[model samples]
Target: MSRIRPQVRISRRLSTTAGVAVTTATLLTAALSPAAHADTRPSRATAIENAAAALLAHAASLGLTSAENTSVRDVIVDKDGTQHVRYDRTYHQLPVLGGDFVVHLAPDGAYRSADRSTRAPISLASIVPKIASPEAAGLAVNALRAANLGTVLKQVKAKPELIVDALHGTPRLAWRTNAVGLDSLGNPVARTVLTDARTGAQIDAWDSIETAAGDGKSLYSGTVPLQTTPSGSSYQLKDPTRGNTYTGDAQGQTDACILSICISRAPAVLFTDADNHWGSGTTADRASAAVDAQYGTDETWDYYKNVQGRNGIGGDGKGSYNRVHYGSNYNNAFWDDSCFCMTYGDGDGTTFGPLVALDVAGHEMTHGVTSKTAALTYSGESGGLNEATSDVLGTLVEWYANNPSDPGDYLIGEKIVKPGFGHTALRYMDKPSKDGSSADYWSSSVGNLDVHYSSGVANHFAYLLAEGSGPKTINGVSYDSPTYNGSTITGIGRDKLGKIWYRALTVYMTSSTNYKGARTATLNAAKDLYGAGSTEYDTVAAAWSAVNVN
Candidate 1:
């Protein structure tokens, strides 16, 4: 859960709590559970929340503590018919900070507990997709970011109305991406739009896809191969002097986050070319994109290869490159295919390094990795995961560095930025609610929360699973996690969790992977690496439930 910053699910018990603490493990123990076929059914967010609340209520009742004895919080399930549960805490004596109980459920519905907590091992990779799946792959595309919509709209230029339609509908991926032109620097420019599944109405807009090839170029040009060689968990950046030292795939100029991609087309940073993303604010300074770019790549690389055993963006032992100093005062960094690199900016001085933080570099790079491997489409449920992946991996990279110059740790983006805007890294995994907004898990009304902050649940869960529940100090940083049922989790090394997650992501997860899918995948992953009925498996399941993934 250590992203550019940290995300954790902590079940902290107050110095006092005499009531409402009855809970038990709800892990389904089936010999060979029913067949799980992936379902292509469109994911309904409303369903996730409803089911979660009902489950919460169910968990609340499981507590052994009597009502007058203590406060209770539990994952309630909506009996109307949704198999979901969530994390909730209640206070019996709010004024005194006493009598508070909480409950958490795992998305897999396999394991759970309340109050009295003990860390048990559980399998990882062997965890399978949720039973909701109707097929082997399940529902895939969930593109719901402003950037992603922009990318889609850019691709379907001929149908502008689809963009509006999507805003009013369930939103589907029924658009085609088309290249348009090239920026002054020669980066490809394109446009896209979404259409109604039935009437083909202008339901949405997808951002464009930028590339080194001309706008007319195909995703895989006949000349340039689509990485003929399989990528993996080890790579060296094309040598610094390889003269591969160019940027702007179109013009081959050296730049980072140059806004050189099809954002004008598919504006989402993930889909756009790195060059096109170079916003002018950060690039305007003499901005040495050099150190920042190299720093990002190296930092990310060490984390994956050394800590997580992941290759490059492709997870096939490939190495991604870095581009620096883009545009006129560019203020941010991003990852893209054309450059396959990370960019940076010179902050307006509110913060020192415009590059944000070393952890951010890993964050953006991991996004590329996530895009290629899990391909968790950027939207709704998966989108939150996608963002969380970036944060988690970014933090892992910092920890991997263990550099005196940087001293990588859980404090994401701290070295590079001190934002006057708000928290340095946009969100906090340790306590999603710390910012005072964002929900930690599925709320029947989760759509109301910002994807960036709303992801706190998953983020916190990951952190707690990695470091254990409760307050502790690491590298001088004091941390505490709020858990369901007011219990505690055990700490597993960040490096180990990173590997399990990486494997689950690149090897097991599919485009349609969701909260439920993530649970199963991680559980399965634990099995693949640690063995069935191992301590790892139990903890993995317990951690998920701790966040109401149940």
Candidate 2:
């Protein structure tokens, strides 16, 4: 149960928005009116092919290619004016998790999951639901195909067993948390800006969440916006400051309910169309894939917000974009240079699966946060600090989300581990020394292991700086973490530790910072948060000495 080979550990793929628009009522059908057909003469099947071909042409310009295209299977124009063209294979691609998807169109104007082998129809009425009345406004699979979309995977592999009906009509928008409500096309938004509906006087403050996404791009979501004048229309826009799940369990993470995120710079807000086409998978799972890639992104934003008084990813009071499920069972998760988005993989029941753990999610996304903030390189000691910064805050988020419903602890990757490999998670903070692979002290060669494992010393130091060197039980287990010089170091709590560490990461540490820099940073951060000669300051100094970090 204690030690296993690194091979089992090596098989895992590791981690890691913006905007607004207020407008008048606009129809969001993407513009659709069935092509005029003189009922007198029945339209030929070639007509269907031509239309589908045209749809693909539109898709080509959207960057869809190779495995992300679609194919038109059949077409049907029922007795009414509805056009339900059956797509034999509707391919999908998740930006984060490289997976695949195949869709089907129901005779009843609904889209369903396609069983490429049996051609069995899986109900789309469940996953995406049937909100678009005419269904004519839906994406033109054939046209998108012509543009850049591709076909179904030749080789099929097992995928997450998704029951579409589970996500049917209800659409699961903000299903768990509040009253403001989520919009129809999967955007969770609420109107907050309110004017007198009279004169545009200086009678009140600007209402509405500070940042908003999707609605700016949902050209098809037709809803009349609120007018500012008192005699005009008064719309209550969500206050980005008010709606965030910041203080408690949410700690910047989304609940099934809080649609209060201030996404300012997200690129794929409205016109974003994900393609879940790894090798063989479904789009839903691909959607799920994004969960791991950006889960901590929220944590990172929150960490900076609460700890550093920053906003969004850039700390510029803006937001960032994230795309998941880029391709099938992707073996890894990475942040790209161009988009600053996270990518992930679906595990093979061993090592690789959902990367939704609070810390893991934060750790990966923090890579970018670190890049933009500290610009820490991925080698030498600064790199170690960069990785540790994520782990430290990731754990902070876990604690911030601490609830009796789902109690929090100082273990990483615990949720994703299974029975084999001792079911042990990644690094342990309570007693970093307990994990044989991690270091209790920064060594000359401490940067030898994977960043995940090598950052243990810093993780250990964080624990000591906050909680102090002690023997205590966290969760169900108990352990005593050691300090290098064997000095009796006084510890604080995770929150205090977080404030100090965060200040250090953002204000002091540079790209080439090493262990010595970490010590100076902690001392400086403590001095900044508390007084220079305060207990917090001295404790930070003692903690560094105790851990031999200096």
Reference-based lDDT, each prediction: 0.45, 0.42
What is the C-alpha RMSD, rounded to one decimal, of candidate 1? Answer: 18.6
Best candidate per lDDT, number? 1
Quote the positional error of residue 219 for candidate 1 in Å.
Answer: 36
What would the TM-score be for candidate 1 when compared with the true structure? 0.55
Q: What lDDT would candidate 2 get against the real structure?
A: 0.42
How do the residues 409-446 of candidate 1 rate in per-residue lDDT, one tens digit apiece?
Answer: 55546655456545554556676776566566655555
lDDT of 2 at 500: 83
How do the predictions measure up, each by TM-score?
Answer: 0.55, 0.48
Query: Which 10 consecutive positions of candidate 1 have the poorest summed lDDT?
Result: 212-221
Clashes of each: 147, 98
**In model 2, what lDDT does residue 374 have?**
44
